[model samples]
Target chain A: MTQLPVRTDRKLGLVIDLDTCVGCHACVISCKGWNTENYGAPLSDQDAYGADPSGTFLNRVHSFEIRPDEGAAQLVHFPKSCLHCEDAPCVTVCPTGASYKRREDGIVLVNEDHCIGCGLCAWACPYGARELDRAAGVMKKCTLCIDRIYNENLLEQDRVPACVRTCPAGARHFGDLGDPDSAVSQLVAERGGIDLMPEQGTRPVNKYLPPRPRDRIGADSPALTAVAETASGFLAWLDRTLDRLPGGGLARMDAPAKEENS
Target chain B: MNPAPSVIIFTTLSGAGFGLLVWLGLGLPGVTGLTAFGFFAIAYLLAVGGLLASTFHLGRPERAIRAFTQWRTSWLSREGWTSVIALILMAGYGAGLVFLGTRWTALGLAGAAMSVAVVFTTSMIYAQLRTVPRWNMALTPVMFLTLSLTGGALLAGQMAAAKALLLLSGIVQIAYWKLGDRALAGSGTTLATATGLGAPRAVRAFEPPHTGTNYLLEEFVHVVGRRHALKLRAIALTLAVVLPLVLLMLGAGHLVAALAALCHLAGVAVSRWLFFAQAEHVVGFYYGKR
Candidate 1:
């Protein structure tokens, strides 16, 4: 059914901490390596070695510079995937009933066999999480590493998503988010983890732990003893001291300003 | 958002086809037996041809039948179902008009209602989506319905009706574009919202997720220049509205009506292209295209 389950005992999801993510892309590479073969259809690359190679990837890591009004800019690496929202639009919008949200684990998935690859699911998604596998003629998306996560044969420690297991920075945490006492749920509450685009109203199961702002670093360091003691601004005292140099120290390096003024 | 030619043709073609069917259901002036056949042939050809064109863009076109199964919650499914109902009703009505020399009022009315409903469902496919804020509006369905009526009136050679609808639909199209522009400009979803980084005054992409243009970028990150759009809109308005209105005023002339229909079709095609090209999906924010 395209309609979401009324309720689920567990909402297994990921909590990504931006503060700890180094943007190394280990998780992305790991997810690609795992899902390409593990999922129902192999994720294919078109012109993989050619001049313009492109392929399907379930996960993507985007880097951005966020400029704040009152502080230095911060670079953040945002890893994105199908959030498996409680109200998964992609699932409900599918005409073929191919896209579905699981009642048991709360993972949203596409039945490749039934998928017509009409691309409606891709359009419905706000996250840009799902991609059409051109070769397989099906939509591909992060399955939350369903095969590995639920495989009885796998070791207990390996029973997690490839991205979570392979994250070097340990920035990714995965567990049942529905249980208030669960580690992931507790972490979300403690860190004030926020849902991306809460206004979108998808009610995503996944949460993102915001990076701690180092707003005062370097810019507001305690003044040096000499610099603090200066009557005028510290730069004025430094200017006078530097004027004693061989070629009027600061002037030589900043001669272009004088030339422009003249 | 790619303005895939197949879909544009599909929507415009089928819309006109269904529009013609609406007029046929209400009854046309040429009530002769073979004339009905001829008119229906054109309507079916365009409607079915457009429906087929839609399938051309699908990756697995063979599995399109599966689409009919999910009408419960999917607008696309409702579209397919309504289209089928409209097509069957119209087809039966055409057959009756051909052999029996009679119009079944109930069947014709139901078919006409379904025809309009099909177009409504089609518009809802995009209008209901929150992903593209510009497309998600009540005006979308109104625009589709208005365009369908205008096209139908033109095809049926109802020059007076066509002229009035042309003017109304033209105004609706302009209003829709104006509202769409404002909606996109003022949309709350930003790069900050996409990445869950709310602190920033402005967030810009330092690096894309990949060097290669992925499916998301290819499918959603369409950019249309404002100057070109304005020019196209002007052309669309002249051809689709102004010229059609002028030509249709040459009342009771089939040649002028046919010419007006052709011009209006060309104009609607342009507007459809702009519709897709201008849509800025929320996913575009991820690629810094929004």
Candidate 2:
């Protein structure tokens, strides 16, 4: 049962665009809301509203500061969940057959009933995707909203993962990555999506589109000089007014005032 | 990696127990009736007691029986199966020698081989984890098997084998530490690779995903101080191998052998603690903990 399928029928997964994520954490909150109420067990929190609060969150947003060789440093909001790897190490490491990857959809899930919470699956995961819920004493992870994605009760548009449905920036996209023609697959192809730690050889189903090259601001950039040189209309009048009021224009303030010097 | 006391006790005690079983199974200290009972008693106490101690860390120990089901792919499951089978085999062999006053050579040999298999399977539990580069090496099993054999020989009072194995295990232990130090770097898993942010661009964890530590951090991101680990390694080598080797060389008397066994167990426990505490899980790279 812990052995991986030769190939998943659908490879349903998320493609997160780092270029557009705003780090709002709406997806994180929505995932917590939906999974806690609907999943096998509620994601438990210890020391809630206390000095040291920690909880089991299926999805988490990590913000990183990345600096390119030539450009200004930028913050990339990295929202991570289970990647549902083709060769999911967590699945094979499970002694109880509790952790498994679905052949039908390739969604890695935990059978909460069988989980002894020895945490070997968590240890096997390089991504830190699985969290052992303190109160429930079972390993909790992103199920990719297994209930919501297939539910007939929800509206057709709402039948996606809680995180994907709730993402304000639309940074998250869900589709059949196994199909090269699928939207997520096309996104990966067009944007040159990359795998996290390909060296680990988990063969993650989900992909990340690296942040686009940022607009660089050099010391002599025209954008910088334009603002200094082209003070037009109201700005020109304000400069003249300031020139009349002070010993000289605002630029002259750097030097000794003419009146004081005299 | 958290070096949970339950796990340390489980591995160390069971390792020594199984090691002793290896020697006993080979009929190295062949005894029958009351004398066999004395040897078997210590073996069962260490092996069974260690197995029992392991259950203390489980979140739902009642469901632990289900862990025996998935042996096809899981090293942990295989470990469960192998340990149980080896213990049962050893029990049968012990009963034959103690109660029936018979050697049961075939049963003894099978149990000895199975006991070694149990130790190998146990080593693979950690050795199979690619996320922990330190444990994911061929040297890991070498370290485990040698240490187990060394401890077993020490307990069995096989003076010649104990001395040789102690020297080998000491060398293997040092080599493991030296090689394990370079494993993470050699694996080429950096903050860059972890985030899919390629090299040349400086990538740093500006803020953590959470304000407080979670299971991943608490479980995997143990940062043993370099000096502290060095100190423990020296102590481990001295106690586990050096002292026991010296004591045995001077004399393998009952008292000396007993003291050597105690020193070996303590040393192995400290070494096992370091084995876990110093294992840098690759997930720590994501949190900038590496």
Worst 10 residues of 1 chain B by lDDT: B193-202
Model 1 lDDT tens row, A20-97:
999999998999999988888998999999999999999889888878886788898989888989988999999999
Q: How many backbone clashes does candidate 2 have?
A: 0
Candidate 2 lDDT by residue in tens digits, A14-53: 9999999999999999999999999899998999899988
lDDT of 2 at A174: 96
For all the predictions, what are the DockQ values?
Answer: 0.59, 0.71
Could you tell me the TM-score of candidate 1? 0.91
Give the CA lDDT, 0 to 100, for residue A159 in model 1. Answer: 95
Task: Output the worst ten-in-a-row residue range by lDDT, candidate 2 chain A.
Answer: A221-230
Residues B184-254, model 2: lDDT tens digits: 88888889999987672499888888889888888998885434999999999999999998898888589
lDDT of model number 2: 0.91
Query: TM-score winner among the candidates?
Result: 2
**Which of the numbered candidates is closest to the native, going by highest lDDT?**
2
